[model samples]
Target: MTTTDAAAAQSTAEEREALRQMAAEFTRREIAPHLQEWEDAGALPRELHVKAGRAGLLGVSFPEAVGGSGGDLLDTVALQEGMFSQGASSGLMSALFTNGIACPHIAAHGSSELVDRWVRPTLAGELIGSLGITEPGGGSDVGNIATTAVRDGEEWVINGSKTFITSGTRADFVTTAVRTGGPGAGGVSLIVVPTDTPGFSVDRKLAKMGWHSSDTAELSYVDVRVPVGNLVGDENAGFWYIAEQFVVERMALAIHGYGIAERSLELTVDYCRQRSTFGEPLIKRQVVRHKLVEMRRQVEAAKAYTHAVAAQYVAAGGPNEAVIAAACMAKETACNTATYVTDQAVQLHGGTGYMHGTEVERHYRDARLLPIGGGATEVLTDLAAKLLGYTR
Candidate 1:
């Protein structure tokens, strides 16, 4: 690399480091204190969004022109890592940063009016936004959405119900995927539906085995009428828009998987060093020492591979075929690491790890969802095979 390139790389490193520190500090002060309370309540307080917005951590990865702190995916990854280091849980992240998934499509493709009305204010924490793609009947076949948005003059009349919607109960609006044309991927279109509009209702908050702090909703839309201007980019381009984000979304889940594993390792290591068994510290035992080594190896390998995939994605400006394959693999690898490491963490913690409200126990439960969300591990593995031409 040339001197100029080297200098730029150094600058990027320094900036990411500073961002990591800021995020970690914010988590220590803001999130760590009352996480359990929110977990118990089964939802986070709206004030948390306001607080994150004020800290500038909430919008760290969005563009400054749209009221964000102006960074990219790598920066957000750093922010995530820092927060995880400071004991941020997966549920906390899903609840606190729902905007990460919600506003990207709007910011990238919405009209200027829509950007101002939704993206800007949402990033500023004055409003909450959510993406509604999953439905009550369909799984990952996003193209087969049962939701219908038929055009009538100047408005699209929408009728459908969405399930497993993250941050759904708290969202001011939903960026909904609806069928506007035929019966395939090409027919899907995105429309922004305000929550309080007539015929829109949050059916209920769904309970989960984990991610308790992150509210999930079952939403119903009965002949909801939204203006034609609420369309994201074009009449039938929602599939492309959503597909475009899959790489980064998968990478984010990869980070979440291994990020919690790293934290679980830390907690387990401390616990082993402190806890006694057979009149000696657990860390002194041969088997316990080996377990710690194996845990570190998995965490390190997953983090390294995921970060590499993220860098490749950033350098390419998007996901090419190779990036997509690597991202899928990275997610699967990290998720596997998370499942193994978190399970080991709990086992190493003994009875304390199984207890509700214990940190390792929380991680153990939260890790279960990573492989399922963002796309199931089985789904991603098959996708990677197809992209890599292994199916032939």
Candidate 2:
């Protein structure tokens, strides 16, 4: 390689190492201690957001101009990998970095006023934000959203509800998807709705199969009035904006998938080494050694593929059709790896793994959400088929 190329490579390595170390330290100091408490409480302290922001961990992949710490997708991958490998669960990642989903559209499209009001504070950790798209019965069908935002003089009266909203109960503002025009995709628009609005309310906190520390809510808006200025981008253009973000969100999930797998494998390896089965170390058994190797192999492969896709995304400046299909594949691949690896981790840990308080148990539960959340594996498979032109 040329001198310039070598320098660039060196610089990148240093940056990645620094990000990883920061993630490890932050997880160890700020999160791991109180993880169980937060999980039991069903929410993280709002103070955690402030600490993450102070540490520049909250907006690592966001634009610096908007109170973010100027980084890219790969930086986020490094952070996630580091955190997971250091005992942080996927639930913590989602709750802490909900901004990765919530503020992107606004940072990229919303007016400066909107950015100042929501994006800046969110990135700075002073405010919590959530993306409201999935509705009851609608699932991943963004086009079929039942929420309506009709213009009434200077304000838009929004009437509808969003379900499975991440960080919803604690969000100060939500970047909500609503119908503003005709039917289907063309009618959709994104509007920022403050939680203080009179008609907006959290219907209830939905208890989940995993990610216990992350708060999820079913939110309702009954004739909630928001200013027209709160609209993100142009009217009836939210679908494209949301579609554009799916690439990153899916990629992030892919990273989460393998990161968790890698962590589980690490925990399992240590367990196997020290765990005695029939008076011998579990690792002494051929079957146990093979299982550990298989777990590592899968985790490495998933990480490599996900990182490659992330690199391609960075190289291309943005995601295109090809990148989108590959992202779907990456997410599915990593999530499947996570499932298998975490299960093996539990199996290797024997009865200890089945216990609720065990680390491997938490990973096992957290890994279960990978395939189902973001875009479900089935839905993404269909999307990939269409993207690859397998569908007529």
Question: Model 1, stretches more than 4 Å misplaced?
Answer: none
Model 1, residue 4: displacement in angstroms?
2.2
lDDT tens string, model 1, 262-329? 99999999999999988999999999999999999999999999999989998998879999999999
For candidate 1, give the lDDT of residue 213: 94
Best by lDDT: 2
TM-score of each: 0.99, 0.99
Count backbone overlaps in model 2.
Answer: 0
User: Model 1 — which ten-residue stretch has the worst lDDT?
Assistant: 57-66
Query: Over the stretch 228-274, how does candidate 2's per-residue lDDT look in tens digits?
Result: 99999999999999999999999999988998888889888888889
Superposed Cα deviation of residue 113, candidate 1 (Å): 0.5
Candidate 2, TM-score vs. the true structure? Answer: 0.99
- Least accurate stretch of 10 residues (summed lDDT) in model 2? 65-74
